[model samples]
Target: MTINLTLRQLELFTATMREGSFTQAAEKLRISQPALSTAIRKIEVELGLTLFDRTTRSVQPTPDGRHLFAVAEDLLRDFKVSMQGVAERASGLHGRLTLAVLPSVAASILPRALMQLQRKYPGIDVAIRDVMHERAVAMVADGLADFAVTTRIAETAALAYDEIGADRIHLVCRDDHVLAKGKGALPWSALEGHAYVAMAGSTSVRRLADAVLLQADFALQPRFEVEQIASCIALVSAGLGVTALPALTFSMFASDRLTMRPLTGPTISRQIGFLQLKGRQLSAPAVALAGEIRGAYGKR
Candidate 1:
């Protein structure tokens, strides 16, 4: 038979059985005896089972009541444990956290932040996607990721961004390249007549570099154009040409023989930020991860 039952009724039944009297169970549950008896009556009527033998002086459990009491005790115990797990997850004690990040930030900034997150919240499993700036924001806006680390998006009105850091454009070349011999910051004009390994025009890193160079009526004369910062760095390390990129991009080439010189003459930098949907509330783990990222930036 399909018998509809409520947890409150089961709790009352089990308590009455344990205490052996309606007066005692009512006191234990902090309810009036009449109210407890009414709730038990409703459950007994619904199940068509006489769960208790009542008398003027005392109460005793029926045979069926003895069996159901055991079941109810176990069910309530398991239910309480399940609810505790849910509560813990809601408070950031356990869960999954996913982030979409720009390639540079993924390589440079996120590692430290993730380490901090793991130490503080060990029960959280992390997933990260290294992508271009535009795609990172797109992932947040599409709900494919909990948050993103990327350059500030100018036209993404549906996404909210909080500035976390900024990375200056640097002229990166092989250590033995002639430009690396200079002592101070390199001027944009120094790039004149130099073969440049450029990133795709759509990238925020390329856009920032080009904007600063254009202020001096200069444009990157590309000898090799690639889509990713890693590719640009690879070409530069191979002595194909020099490239201008954010200092954060240097993290990916940690073992490469590269020298980065700060660029001047209308100095430029890209503002990095955390992006999330404008109106959505982040889960506890995501908020914790965001705080860790900000802390990592401060430390860096």
Candidate 2:
């Protein structure tokens, strides 16, 4: 038969056994002696066995009770260990932090940051999801991600943001591209009539690029458009067309395939940062990871 033992019964029974009397167990349990007796009685009934050799003078365990007591002792010991394990995991930094990051940031920046985080908080778990900027921001807002790092911060009811760092926008072109071969900074007028490869649409990067070109009195000259940043980087790598990008991104990845030159029209920069749901407190893992991300720039 299956039996369900209440924790109170086990505690009472164990205390009484160790104390050698129900009276002492009641004191330890802070209950009336009758209440402690009732608890032991119920436990005995559930097991369908007499637990004690009892009379007026003293109480002693029967063979079955002794066998069960040993088992209960082991069980209680294991239960305490299990509780400690849980406490250590929750109270100690040993759980997963779900992270969402824009595709570009995930490739180079996130990995570097994570390596540093692991060194400091080895117990923390990091579950990283790489997504488009819009989806990444939405993930944090919707509780799907504990934190998100991105270049584009979308203001919504869901997210609160902090500035982690910023990078200047650069004109990235194939190493063979004329601008790549020689440049201190690039003027927008130099590309007044040149074809460009740009982000597909609606992305903050594409919008920023458009605004920059627009103010320079030149309309965007798009030869191709794509959604993924990696694709945009790949386009330039393959010598398709030039595009403006965060300087650190190309600097970290892409060997000689592409070269980044400072975009010198006006102020060309993008702030990179972390975002989370409004009023959401970061977990230990997320906090540790955020610290590592901040440390990546070192003094920024």
Candidate 3:
């Protein structure tokens, strides 16, 4: 037969066993001695076992009572621990957060934001998937990530975008490159006959670069096409060719080798923001981390 027991019953049983007297246990539990005796009698009837040997002078546990006491004490201890963990998680004091972010934002502003998050909520663990803009958006849409920090590439019914800031496109070249010798912002015409190191056609940077080139009516073709930002920076640093990238991504390049000049003659920029599922509420830790990100970008 299945046993039916409430926490209060277990608590009373353990307390009476510890005190060695129903009168003393009831006093400790703030209940009448007769009420405690009735509850214990009900427990004995349900278990179909005699739990205590009672006399006018003393009360003592039988083998069955001893066994039940041990189990009930352990159960009460475990329940207390479980409840504490639940409370901590609900308060954002302990939990895990997963984020999908563009490599540009990951390298530039995300580090500072994470530092602040850690200081405030040290018990929260974070996982980051630093990827291109497209992959970042896909992760959020597919529920593989809690949220994303990336540029808006398209409107999707599954995702919501919150624009935080914009990163201006800049022309990146080796320090010795002719374009780098100029002082101020360079016009699009300056790229006319130069070899271009283009990012892979799939990247958000490449898409924006292509749009800007088309708008300027420039017909230059790429000399090299690379998939990673590091590769593009390496080629430019080696004086192979020049490439255009957003200002936020410039953090990955070594300043001693490469120089970035703002692109003008109709300057181009991309919106950077948070991407999360529509109508989904974020976890407390996710909300806290997003606040830190907003603070980091607000300064810029």
Note the Cα lDDT for every prediction shown.
Answer: 0.87, 0.78, 0.90
**Per-residue lDDT value at 187 in model 2:** 86
Q: What is the C-alpha RMSD of each candidate to the true structure, in Å?
A: 4.0, 5.7, 3.7
Instruction: Rank the candidate models, highest TM-score first.
Output: 3, 1, 2
On TM-score, the leading prediction is 3
Clashing pairs in 2: none
Off by over 4 Å in 1: 1-73
TM-score of 3: 0.77
Ranking according to lDDT, highest score first: 3, 1, 2
Q: Is candidate 1 or candidate 3 better by lDDT?
A: 3
**TM-score on alpha carbons, each prediction:** 0.76, 0.70, 0.77
On residues 1-300, what C-alpha lDDT tens digit does candidate 1 reach at each position?
788988888888888998999999999999999999999999889989899898898788899999999999999999999999899899887899789988888788889998988988898888888888878877888899999988887766698889988899888889999998967799988988888998888899778877887788877678998997768877888898998988888788764588889989978889999899988999999988989889988887
**Once model 3 is optimally superposed onto the true structure by TM-score, how far is the C-alpha of residue 35 displaced, in angstroms?**
3.2
Q: What is the alpha-carbon lDDT for the whole of candidate 2?
A: 0.78
Better of 1 and 2 by lDDT: 1
TM for candidate 2 is 0.70
Among these predictions, the greatest lDDT belongs to 3
Question: Per-residue lDDT for 183 in model 2?
Answer: 56
